[model samples]
Target: MKQWIFLVGAIISEVVATLSLKAGMDNSIFYIVVLIGYVLAFVFLTKALKSGMALGVAYGIWGACGVAMTAFLSHLIFNEPLTSIMVLGIVVIIAGVLMIELGSQAATRKEKGNV
Candidate 1:
């Protein structure tokens, strides 16, 4: 539970950081947010790992969610393009992450059964 919370924080942070990186191109002050966001992202990710979340699952979720949210939000907030192809790519990323998560769960269950 705590690990999932931490992972969510990490994903949000990474997305914020990525978006800030783009916004910072106009106003340098956004760079501060970018730095803080990325740092906190890693910190939360570490907490998630320490809370017994598998690294592959944690990173897969973080990266995929971060990419999805960043792209969507960038389209809304920054007037960036959200073409159909990009949306498809995001969907594929989400599907890949889901598969990774399921595989990790099955592997964990198998290991526990073996033990």
Candidate 2:
């Protein structure tokens, strides 16, 4: 549970960092935010890894969620248009992440001879 918290933090950090990149284009101060956001993101990601979350599972979730969240946030923050196809792609990304998570759990259970 703690590991998941770290992972969530990591994801949020990454998303913020990515958005900060766009903001940084206009103001140099936002560049500082971008750097700090990325650094904190990696720090939390490392903590999640140290806490025993599988790399594949953690990375998959992080990347997929980041992409989805970034898209949504861009739409809200930048007034970017989100087409139906883009929304469908986000749904597919989420489904894939879910599949990865389920597979990871099954693998762990099998390793423990619980399957």
Candidate 3:
């Protein structure tokens, strides 16, 4: 449970860092913040990964969550478009990630039962 929370935090931190990287294009101070955020994010992410989370499942969750949040943040911060196609793509990505997580869990459970 705690690892899940850490995973989410890591994704949020990564998104913030990525967005800040863009916003910091002309400002050294903003760049510094971006660097710090990225470092801290990775630190927590590695901890989560080391805490018994499967690599594929963890990464899928991170990628999907980051992509979705990044898109929303882009729209809110940079006024990027929120077209239907974009929304659809995000939905698809999220669904796929969820399937991967679920599938892996089911496989693990089945393997455990067989043992």
**TM-score per candidate:** 0.95, 0.97, 0.92
Q: After superposition, how far is residue 61 of candidate 3 from its true place, in Å?
A: 0.8
lDDT of 2: 0.94
TM-score of 1: 0.95
RMSD of each: 1.5, 0.7, 1.6
Please list the residue runs of candidate 1 whose C-alpha ends up more than 4 Å from where it truly belongs after superposition: none
**By the TM-score metric, which is better: model 1 or model 2?**
2
Residue range 1-115, candidate 2, lDDT tens digits: 9999999999999999999999888888998889999999999999999999999989989999999999999999989889999999999999998999999999999999999
Predicted candidate 3 versus true structure: per-residue lDDT over 1-115, tens digit per residue: 8788889888988998989988887776788778887897888788888887888988999999899999999999989899999999999999999999989989899989952
TM-score of 2: 0.97
Runs in model 3 lying further than 4 Å from the true structure: none
**What is the lDDT, from 0 to 100, of the residue 72 in candidate 1?**
96
Model 3 lDDT at residue 27: 74
